[model samples]
Structures are given as C-alpha cells and as structure tokens.
Target chain A: MRAAGRRAPALLVLVSVLLIAADHWITLTPLRAFGSGVYGSLENVTSSVTRWASDARRLETVERENARLRAEVLTGRRPTAAVAGAAAAYQVVSAHAIGFGGDQTVTLDVGTGSGVARDMTVLNGDGLVGRVVQAGPSTATVLLATAPSSSVGARLETSREVGLVTGVPDRGLLRLSLLNADAAVRVGDRVVTLGSENMRPFVPDVPVGSVVAVEGTSGALTRTALVRPFAHFSTLDLVTVVVGPGRPGDGAPQ
Target chain B: MRDPARKPAGNPAGRALLAVALVLLAPVAQVSVVNGLGLPGGGPDLVLIGVVTLGMVLRPMAATVVGFAAGLAADIAPPADHSIGRHALVLCLIGYLCALVPADSSAGQRTAAALGGTLGGALLDAALAGVLGDESWTSVLGGLPGSLAWTVAGGTLVAVALVSLLPRRRRFGGPASRAAARGHYTGGHHA
Candidate 1:
C-alpha cells in the first residue's frame, strides 16, 4: 500500500507525459474539428461588429462627398466625370481583424465561410493589406503585403506605368520596381494593383499606397520606389477581404 | 472531502487536477487574452512562459509533462496546418532545459532563464522552419529581434506576477523557517 501510494503521483505523471508525447504524431486532428466550430461562431460575431464599424465610417465619407457633389451640381452641372469614375472604380466589403497564430505568419477568423477565398485580396481602409494565401472553412492565412515572400504587380495611378511591388520583411515596407530606369513614376503617386484577366486574385485600381521615394542603383536595371503601405498593420483592428462579385476574368493568379 | 484548502501533500489526484487546469486554461488564455492584444507579428506566447516557470521549479519528469501539456495547447492554434509538431517538440526541449537551471537560483536568475528559454525556443522553431523550406533564414531573422523582445518581456512580466501572487515561504535555515514548515517532506518521516 505504501509503495503504491508513493508511486501513484509518479504513475499519473508518467501517463500524462505519454499522452502529451502522443500529440506530436496526431497534430490537431480531433481537436481542430471542435476548434473549427468554436472559431466559426466567433467569426460571425466579429464579422458583424466590423461591418457595423465600417458602415458608420462609410456614411461619414459619403455624407461629406454628398455635400461636395451638391455644390458641384448647384453650379448647374451633372455629376462630374471624375466623381462618377471614382465611384465605379472599386467595391468594398468589411471584415473584422480577428486572432492570429503564435508565429504571427497566419491570421484567422475570416474566410470563405465568411465570404473570403483564395486569390481574393484584403485591405485596410487606408490601403492594400495582403492577399488570401489559403482559406479554410472559417479561417484564412492572409499573406500580408509586408511579408518577404509577397510580390504584386503594381501600377502608378497617375502615369499608369507598371512595376512590381515586393515586400521587405525587416523594414515592414514594400518597394515598387519599374522596368525602365527613367519611368515616369514619382513620389506621392498612387500605387494600385495591376489587374490581369479574371481579376484572378486582385482586381485593378485598389489603392495600395503612395510612392514614398525613388532609389538609385549601384547597378540596377530597374528603378525602385519605396512604398509606405497605407494599412497600419501594427494596429489593425478591422479589414476587408474582397470576395467575388465576379470581374470579367477573375479566379486564377493574375 | 478533507479541508479543501489543505489537501494531503503529494496526492496524485490533486496534482492531476492541477495539471489539467494548466492544460485547459493555458491555451484558452493564450487565445482570448494574448491574441486579443495583438502586436505586429502577433501576441506573446503566455503559455510558453507559464510552462517554463513551472518546469524550472519541478522535477525533470514533471517538467516534461508540463511542457508537453502546454505545447499541446499551443499546437491547437489555427495555423496548426503549416507547423504541427514544431511547438510540441520545441516545448519539450524547453521543459528539459528548464530542469537544468540550478535549484538554488535567485529570482533574477530564474527570470533570466525563462527569458532565455523563450528566445532560444523561438530561434530553434524559426531555424527548423527555415530548414523545412517554409521560410528563408533572412526572412525569419528579420523578424527575430521583435519576436525575441516580445517573448522575453512577456515571460518576465508573468514570472514577476506569479511570484507576487504566491504566498511567501520562509527560506530554509532562516529565523522563521521552523515555524513556517508545512509538515511535508518528499523522503523523510516527521513526528
């Protein structure tokens, strides 16, 4: 009795140790099924909250624009082409910025279940954030535009000159590289995604950010523009991952 | 039930309850509170700090158990897809390292060990990912400083808080040691 009593704590500890070790082989198989359900519910709650917040902000902007447009119309003119063109350029959906994984490489609580999907793009109200790398039922990993592996085809909204936007992980900055050294691109020019057929992932004309600077090459074939992404990633509270309204050529990688 | 506040020392059942509480509570806290306070890359790993603290105070076998349980909680995170066993295995190593800290360590030493353990484990995890081709060394290294600072800060804060919360026990061979004795000994008979 004494020996058994003495050994009991050790034995219980031993058994738990074995069970924990078992976790290495199994991964999240059984637990994840349950976790997904929990996360799914949370996603609903957060999505609704974000939608309300964004709607309020949208109302503010619209009201201001309404005042401005009224002034323009009062001068005996119809809706100006510039104002109409801007409205037709893009659509916005609101999403909650939910939880993240430990390493921070992945974000969760927004996906196809909440109307997000692969190849669809996401952004903060200010500018482009990232594209959906993978979408699970109720979760997705948004490859942030600042992630090192991220690359996007971009164009200067002013000149319509094309370039590639690449991420610098360390600085949390994005760079736009133009093929022609003397391309008409300049600082403060609007940068937007260069949309290709099907809008495969990103539809054209979404504001990414403004060019912050132009860098000279030691031996460069292309000119690189420093881009300060508009999305304040550090304090991101809400975002919108664009789901399909079906652009003419959307679905595959652009 | 005997006085709930005064359970028999070394009771397997009570210990089991404690371990279970740690496992269940750790991850839930990590998800709800830790992740809710998001920084750039993500929030600090609180469960990792908790496991390291307990492991430092426990026996080798017990530390491993705590490490396993805590790591398993972490492994249940949403991104379990990209890296499954990475945390579990890494935490197991952290538990073992915790046991190696000197038993007579000062609070500062324990705090240092906890911070070191967190940073070391994070680097190991990043390196393993690099080897797996999931990420490049430069990319992982770029995020290293910020991640390390977060882990160390979180660990130190939790350690200080836990120490403050636990009732102070008189040091052995001190003036009040005899009166403060709890009548529990691992390998001795008391009359």
Candidate 2:
C-alpha cells in the first residue's frame, strides 16, 4: 500500500503533461467520434436554455423601452424614417449559437443546414460578428470580426465616409485605419460595411458599430479610428448568419 | 479513530468494486448533473475529481490505472474535440499525486491533496491553451469558480460516501469490528 501510494504522484504528472500535448497536436476525428453523441445532446440542451434566457432578458429590456415609448406615442409622435431604418439594420435572425472549436475560432451550427453559406456574414444585431470562414455539413467556423486576420472596409452610415477595419487579436478589439484625410469621422458615428468591387458578401447598409475613438492628424497620410464592436462575443448566445443576396455570376459557382 | 478489530488493508474484491463504481459515476454525473445545471463555460470535469479522490484512497498503481481508464472515458465522452487520450493522461497524473500523499494523514489532509490534484489538471489546461494562443479569459473565469467548487464538493462527497457504504454492504459494518473473523483460519490449520 505504501509502495503504491509513493508511485501515484509521479504517474499523474506524466499523464497530465501528455494530455496537454495531445490536445494541441492531435486531430478531431477520434475524439469527436467518442464524444459526439454526448456533445450533441449537451449542445441541444444548452442551446435551448440559452435561447430561452436571452428571450427572457430581451423581453425585459423591451418592456422598459416600450413603456417609455408609450408616453411618446400618447403625445402623437410616430417613428421617423431614419429611426426605423436604423432599427431595421440592428435586426438579427436569432439562431442558436452552438459548438465551438479551432484555435481562436468556433463553429456555429448555422450553415447551409441552417441557411448559412460560404462568405455569408454573421452578426449579433448590434455590430459585426464575422464571416463564415469554412462551412461544413451543418456547421461553419466564424473568422470573427475581432480576429487579427480579418479586414472589413466600412463606411460611416451618416456621412458615407470609408475606412478599413482591422482586428486587434490580443485585445479582441477592432481598429479602423486608412481613411480619407477630410473624412468627417467622430466618436459616435455609425460604421457600416461598404460594398466592395470584388464581391459584397455583406449587405450595403447593415449597421456594424459606432466609432469609439479617432486618431491621426487631418492632413496625415492615413487616419485611423477605433470602433467598439456591437456584439458581446464572449457571452453571445444567438446570432444571425446572413445568407445575403447572390452576387453576379455566382449561380452555377463559376 | 483507529479501529482495533479487523485488518486495515481492504480485500481485492471490495477495492475492485469501488473502482468500477467511481468509473461509472464520473461520466454519468459529468454529462447529466454537471452540464444540466448550466453553471458556466461548459460541462464540469467530474472525471478529474473522481480520479483525485480515488487516488487518495487506493494504492498508487491502482490509482494510476483507474485514472487512466477514467481519463480515456472522459476523452471519449461528448463535447470533446481533441484526441482520445488527452484527458486520460491528465487524470492519471491527478490520481497519482493524490495517491502519493502519506497514508497517516487525515480527511482534512486528503482534501488538500485533492485540491492539488484538481489544480494540477486545470493548470495543464490553461498552460496548453496559453501556448497555443487560444486562451479565452472570459469563459475560463466565467466557469472556473463553479467548476472548482463543484469538483471539490463532488470529490469529497463521493469519497466519503463510498468509504461509508462499502463495509456496510458486505454484511458487517462500522470499520470492520471483528478481528477474529478477519483472522479466521481453515483447512488443516489445527494449531
């Protein structure tokens, strides 16, 4: 008994080190095969619970806002066109977020199976979420809007000025750089994805986020701005992966 | 609180059954109770706590074997996306460490040992995530307190419950209070 006790600690350390090493180097096949059913069930249960929780939370917030709006309605004022348009851009599909993987990436269960597809954009109805990096049978990996590898050309919704939004990997923040010198960018200006010549996978007038800070001189060769992402990616429960309108010559996958 | 009646060392059958029960309970509880509760980042790592607690009571080799088996089971369980042996290795280390503690220690000491075992497993996870540049502080911190708390509580509960239940089910109870029965001799032993 004493002898066995002495050997236990050494064995445990060795095992732990091995497990850590393997989680990094190995592929997902065998592991998934072993636990897929269990994970699938857990995913189903958790996703439903999160959906319910978010719905409940959203209702409470709407109730408070609705009460405030009721007073305004009583005074005989209707929503202006601009206000209605802004609200429309913030609307989302509200599908359940499920199954995470990759190094800094995660797969959402919304794919072709959920009407999501390649290059289709995703968001939280607040700001940019990400684009579908890779789509599989019923899952897609989102190259998040905050990923270092991501770059989105966005324009100010109100001013129609353009800038390049880049991801700051370490801080999980998005930085907008290389804007026109005379661009009327401000701290609270709305940023939206601009249609690009190659292909506009995202819609033209979707509300991405508000500019939080601006940098560089007016005459500086390139100006930069910091945009606060609308989506709370960390605690996000549901998102909309937009299957945007088809681009030209994409009917048969030329 | 040493009992002077029966031998302190447990029989092979009793030890084997205890190991089996722990193995079965680890996965079932992890998937059902831990995940069903929705405490945090994901499911609770119940196999880790089970390995640590079992390691504290069993022989070192026995603990290692059980840990390895439990880890394999965990790796193969749902929601895991890596290889099959990752958890097996981690749990084995936790079990081994718990077993290495001196036998003369009390339950209080075992709790400390179990804590070390749990921490060792968690540290391995954090360090690996850090090296790969895949660390997410939000989910880690979000789920950590609940996971750690449940592990400690669940580990302790299983350990004590098993210890109390084993002897009673074998017909005689209360710490083997029959030295003569344990020392019973037969078949030509007419001294």
Question: What are the TM-scores, per candidate, against the unseen true structure?
Answer: 0.68, 0.56
**Cα-based lDDT at residue A60, candidate 1:** 92
**True contact recovery of candidate 2:** 0.27
- Local distance difference test, candidate 1: 0.62
Give the poorly placed runs of model 1, Cα more than 4 Å off.
A1-93, A101-108, A247-254, B1-43, B57-62, B72-76, B79-82, B99-112, B158-191
Interface RMSD of each: 6.6, 8.5
The 10 consecutive residues of candidate 2 chain A with the worst lDDT sum are A245-254
Looking at model 2 chain B, report the run of 10 residues with the lowest lDDT sum: B182-191
> Residue B94: error of model 1 in Å?
1.0
Stretches of model 2 off by over 4 angstroms after superposition = A1-30, A33-37, A49-94, A98-120, A131-173, A177-184, A194-206, A215-225, A243-254, B1-89, B99-104, B136-191
- For B124-183, candidate 1 gives per-residue lDDT tens digits of 777866775556688777767777777878777855754553324324234333322222
* Number of residue pairs clashing in candidate 2, backbone atoms closer than 3 angstroms, sequence gap of 3 or more or interchain: 11
Distance from true location, Cα of B185 in model 1, Å: 13
Displacement of residue B83 (Cα, Å) in model 1 is: 2.3
User: How close to the true structure is residue A146 of candidate 2, measured as C-alpha lDDT?
Assistant: 76
